[model samples]
Target: MTPLVELSGAGFAYEDGPPVLRGVDLALREGRALALLGRNGSGKTTLMRLLSGGLRPASGVLSLDGVPVSYDRAGLTRLRTSVQLVVQDPDDQLFAASVEQDVSFGPMNLGLPREEVRARVEAALAALDITHLRDRPTHLLSFGQRKRAAIAGAVAMRPRVLILDEPTAGLDPDGQERLLDTLGVLSGTTVVMATHDVDLAVRWADDAAVLTPAGLRLGPAADLLCDPELLTAAGLRQAWSPAVTAFLRAHGLLAPGAPGPRTPQALTELLGGRPHP
Candidate 1:
């Protein structure tokens, strides 16, 4: 299948500094979840902005579903409608007085019919499990609720690809789990998330990519999370869950592998039995 989004040899730089992104190439396929992992200032946010067409690449090409994206107003608007980006801070996206209005803003801005906008808002709220928050004041919501509202706004746009920058940041375990479960059920949409949570990436993402001062590298999440050396190189650390380590050691599967755990299911497949004790 053709990729939902593709970036080829993409590079970007602010007015004064060196290029934040250099020769970055990525292809996000439909229904796949890709985790973007790196340390601070590794250009992950720059790459996200480039992908969402918020910033044009200084060189190379960005395409959506095979069509090249240009910097022209129409081209950029089309790209924005197809690829929605959720920023790290929820407050950046939630501007409307009420949650429903905030979620409806995107579709309404697209000139969708009022009824369609309402349906989209309702669906998005339901998808994010924030239907009860529909009439609440956005400013009064907690951090996790604001995050969900932001996500709901993105989903309301009905984009084919969802680009999330640090979706799990600043959330408790329960909040994180809730967001992860919601993201997991969003099928047929290409999801690319830039996050610092190695464990969440290992558990949630199907594939993983790392950005370093050197450049961008792509591989299976399991391989990346398992490799201590690779993690160190990328300015990340292994998310060695106690259950995962015990399972791997009991099954003799911890000898060596790719850098990361990849997924919780990998342990079951490797062990071929219930985890010991």
Candidate 2:
């Protein structure tokens, strides 16, 4: 299948600065959850911007469904409506007085009819499981609630692809789990999340893209995330989930052909209550 969005030979650099990303090529598959992994300075954010039409590549092309992306207003509007980026900081995105207003902003700007905007807002709020907080002030929400609210604003646009940067940052374990559950509700949307947490990437993403100064590597999460050399090259450590799952398989506790467990609870269930050898 053709990629929903693709970057070919893309390169970026700040004004007169050294290149942050060079000759980068990436393709986002439809409806697949992707984890963008790299160290702090690996141009992950830059790549996300390029995908979202926030930045024009200094070289090469960014294509949407095989068509080259245009930076003109009409083209950008199409891109923004089809692909939404929710930055790491919710405070930067949410400015409306109330949750409902914030979520409604994007659709309203799209020149949508009042009823359509209302329906979109309702569905987005419900998807994020924050319908009850609709009337609340955006400034008064907790960190997790604010994150969900910000994401709801993007969801209201009904984008085909949703990109999140450091989505689980600053959240407690419970908050992270809740956010992941909420993300699960975005069933038809392709989700791409940039994160520093290798374990989260290993367990949550269907595909993994690791960036390094040397290059970018994209493949099945189970394959790339388990490779110690690739992890080290990307300045990431091997995730413990795969290690434990590998041990279980080696001990004959797990079927050799079975997919690795994504979490501690999943590992336990897969073991079928058998004691560790």
Candidate 3:
């Protein structure tokens, strides 16, 4: 499948500073979730911002669907409509007095008819399970609620691609799971996120990209997430599932062909109350 977005030899430097991202390449597929892993100051944010059209690269090519991305007013309007970005900090994005208005803002600004905007707002609220808070004041919402509201605002735009920066940050375990479930159902939209949560990234993303000062590496989650050298390069540790799988395999309790499950429920079912030998 053609990628929703592709980066080739992409490099960026801020106002004559040293390059933050250098020759980094990525191909984000439609309907697949791509997780970006990196340490602080590793240019993950720069890459996300570049992809979302917030910052243009000083060198190399960034394209959407094989065509180069345009940065002019007409170009941006189309890009913003096709790709919605939810920043890591919800407070920076949410400015409306009420949840409903906040969620409706994007569609309304799109020059959509009022009724159509209403429908989009309603669907976005329902999708994020924030319908009950529709009339609530934005200031009174909890951090999690605010995050959901922020997400709803973007989802209301019905973008073809959604990029979230550290979306799981500040979310509780259950909240993370709920968000994962919601992301899973974004059927035809490509989802890209930069997150510090290695465990979730291991299982959730269809593909993984590890960003280090050296460069960026992209591959299947299965191959890249479990590689210790790659993990160390990106300042990440081995994921928990692989360790458990190794232990069980060594103990002769698990079949050699047994599949390692990544999620909590999958692990619970796989163990089946089996006693440790």
The sequence of per-residue lDDT tens digits that candidate 2 reaches over residues 55-92 is: 99999899999999999999999899899999999999
Query: How many Å off is the CA of 61 in candidate 2?
Result: 0.3
* Per-residue lDDT over 58-116 for candidate 1, one digit per residue giving the tens place of the 0 to 100 score: 99999988889878999989899989999999998889999998998889999988999
User: Which model is ahead, 1 or 3, in terms of TM-score?
Assistant: 3
Winner of 2 and 3 under lDDT: 2
Residue 164 in candidate 2, Cα distance off native in Å: 0.3
Q: Rate the local accuracy (lDDT) of all candidates.
A: 0.86, 0.93, 0.87
Better of 1 and 3 by lDDT: 3
lDDT of 3 at 249: 89
Question: Which tens-of-lDDT digit does each residue in 1-277 have in candidate 3?
Answer: 7777888899999996888998988888878888999999999889988888899988888788888888999877777888889999999999999999999988988899999999999889988999999999999999999989999999999999899999889989899889989888777888998988788887798899999767998998877888888888889878888777777889886799887766556667777854343
Clashes of 3: 0
CA deviation > 4 Å runs, candidate 3: 263-277
Shift in Å, residue 157, candidate 2: 0.2
Report the Cα RMSD per candidate. 4.0, 2.3, 2.3
